[model samples]
Target: MTDLLTIRGVSKRFPGVQVLTGVDFDLRPGEVHALMGENGAGKSTLMKILAGLQPADEGQILHRGEEIALRSPLDARERGILLIHQELSLSPELSAAENIYLGAWPTNGIGLLRKSELNRRAGEALKALGCDVGPKTRIGGLSIARKQMVEIARIHAFKANVVILDEPTASLTDAERDQLFATIRDLKARGVGIIYISHKMDEIFTITDRITVLRDGVVQGTLATGETDADRVTQMMIGRKLDAFFSRAEEKFGAEVLRVEGLGRRGDYHDVSFRVRQGEVLGLYGLIGAGRSEVVETLFGIRRPDRGKLWWQGRETAFPSPRQAIDMGLCLAPENRKEQGLVLGLGGRDNIALPSLRVFSTFGVMRHAREQAVYLTYRDLLQIKTTGPATALRTLSGGNQQKFVLAKWLCRKPKLLVLDEPTRGIDVGSKAAIHALIAKLAEDGLAVIVISSEMPEVLGVSHRILTMADGRLTGEFSGAAMTEENLIRAVAHHAA
Candidate 1:
């Protein structure tokens, strides 16, 4: 019953922030421990310390009754501990076998690489994790789910005793997640301990044995998963009672804001047609690579349609570029917020003002005061947490980054808004706020389109739901017909 690893009195501090304070954690063999926290609740700090990415200001880590010094990630890995980050760390151009044994490749006595042995070992490791991917397959060519499998296979190959997985299922599909759970169970049977960190309540309750909650850099408490409920866990993390997670307003559809007829983008999506009405939220639901994003991208002029027609307020219109779409009163907050929406090096004020610069400028002269006022308005409205308006966007958490992306498009006062994976990678509290904001935007008469992989989100926020599969619209449902079962059936009905 002895713990495999234990953290005692851990503390970490930055210039203006105390990220962790007297936090303690433990991991036992064959156990999956859940780490729960809000966006800025010091969970990442603790994990980084465990992985030896950064040294704790004051703390001690014990392994099997003996204190240990973890000076670097290499030290931790050598001790049979591995951390799989939310952002995957893999060489995209390398083959699966090469990446599996990246720094520790097999070699012959003459110092030449042993390709056959390497591939055989990699294939065995992948098979142990129940993955079917070929060892010679390129890492970049694999899907996110397959890439995750490869990551797990690497851990198995390394014989890691303790594995730290951060948001492991963030981008995975339902089937892929089930596969991952099977792999986790296999690891558990093999006596490996897992440290799981995620914002999803369902996942935590389903997979974890014990739950530890952190708030404001301190440990609130730890409880056995079977003995505690989600309500208690949420209260512990946020120190407040959360209102209903999903807040949907009354449905009141207005005149059609956009109508697409037979929209096709050759290899991406084809024959996609839908209509969005003012003061209504249209939810697009599908599996990954289901052409949902492509449809919205075409509408926002990010992709040109090979054959189709778009009608804007009853007038046939064609937007050759995103700028043209913006000029025509349409804006898209893309799925990859960091890569496609915000400039990480820029400050919050600058990012929110980027899309609406013309509104604050006159005669090609910049208006600092006006821009600041607009930025402050959105900063307050979106409840963006930052030390100052000038703080770099990269310094903010994932949730706040998403809020900034929303503020950028909201500031434009566009007639139609397209939000793709708007709540991906955000915490529960932030998700509720964003959901409420989406409802409010629709209430205020802005046509909205939300493309999300989360079924609950799509069902809760949309007045209507459209299902896509294999680059085409498979089905549409609304009102009482939009259950999860029906949505899944619709997506699978057109499967190739």
Candidate 2:
């Protein structure tokens, strides 16, 4: 394989933080190069530089045997580079054909909305990628997997020589992932180089030819997939041996803290029945679309289950809204902290204390002194990376923003907590801190329900685990029964 692109001594610094420091990396033609790192390890920064979205403070990027200055995405696009971000960017109302040929449309002598021609071209593109999206169907009506297929189709439409995929299968099922791998294989057949970025060790081993590991804004090492195992690759990413990431916690149970019977939400969850005890961490295990999120959301009052009974402390409760759930000692720290969990436009103090807005107010006026005092306590406790409480969420790193999200919910001091993928994309340090907090919470006799796709995380913090399939509970296992093999078998059965 020949080097299609090379980055040398790349460095970038912000006002007070060094995001990337003297990094070196490369991408080869017709090869799938996997990039591995914990969050905040300069992976995103390096990709941004290659895509021409951000400039580096000091470095050289070589393309096709020439040192080049890519000022913008258009400049990179002209040089055959396409980046597919974690967040999907597509017009929900637009059809597949419209989104595929959005800006650079093939127009005739007199430009008009070309329907038949657009649909035919889009069908060909989708056919090439093995996508089943109707060219004229609105994107809003498509499933997440199908929409992702459209995004891949968009990449194929551009005919880019190099493609950057960041966490492409994070939100996909087993079947969807197989389909995506097929698409990648087809792309590789056409000699398109791909940079596969993810935290999934199994995925890198299965699909990528070579793997590059980064730690603390530096290259750890690069090894061929055939020569390295997942354990070795993980050790490289985290700088230590992780034989048991899913920790074996002590088993302690208290009185029933939360009980739900006959829970039913139309088109979502149905006939859900469970009880969470104090001093216990209940793990809800499922595939991406198996209604794991819906069950928790319904419990948190984000979605009201049409026919159900909720009991807290042996008393019936009616939670009409999230506020009601919070009032009853139930709260949720959502999965997507950047969007659903925190307000980027607001300062850290405001975002943290936003849930408890009523407490910081007297006669309908928010008091800054009260808010700042509370923020100070959590800032030190959570060790959030920020200049001050007044700093905006946007200015902080992804890990820091997530810390703030957890801080906000902690301020509520609820008894029953619903956490969805508590550490989706964070650094090792942050992950450790959050795990410690969870242990402390369970020790304090707080009822905690954790839902995570990461098997290690689920197995780490839970006293017992329940597997959900489609919309019903199918399996339940204790800490003793929690092994990688057993867990996979349970989820696979549910999927069937």
Q: What is each predicted model's overall lDDT from 0 to 1? A: 0.88, 0.82
**TM-scores, all models, native as reference:** 0.93, 0.91
Cα lDDT tens digits for candidate 2, 1-496: 5588888999998776788888888888889999888777778888989999999999999886689998998888889888887767789999998888777667777987668888888888888777778889899898766787788787778888889998888667677789889989888888888999877767888899999888868899999999989778878877887654544345677889899899888888778888999888999988877688898888777887789898888888774488788887788888778768998989899998888989889989999899999999988998776877777887666678878887888888888888898877665556766787888888888889999988888888888888877777768888568777777877777321
Flag regions of model 2 displaced more than 4 Å: 229-232, 239-244, 427-429, 483-496
Which of the numbered candidates is closest to the native, going by highest TM-score? 1
lDDT by residue (tens digit), candidate 1, 171-237: 7778778888988888899899999999988999999999999998999999999999999999998
Which residue pairs of candidate 2 clash? Answer: none
- Candidate maximizing lDDT: 1
- In model 1, pairs of residues that clash are none
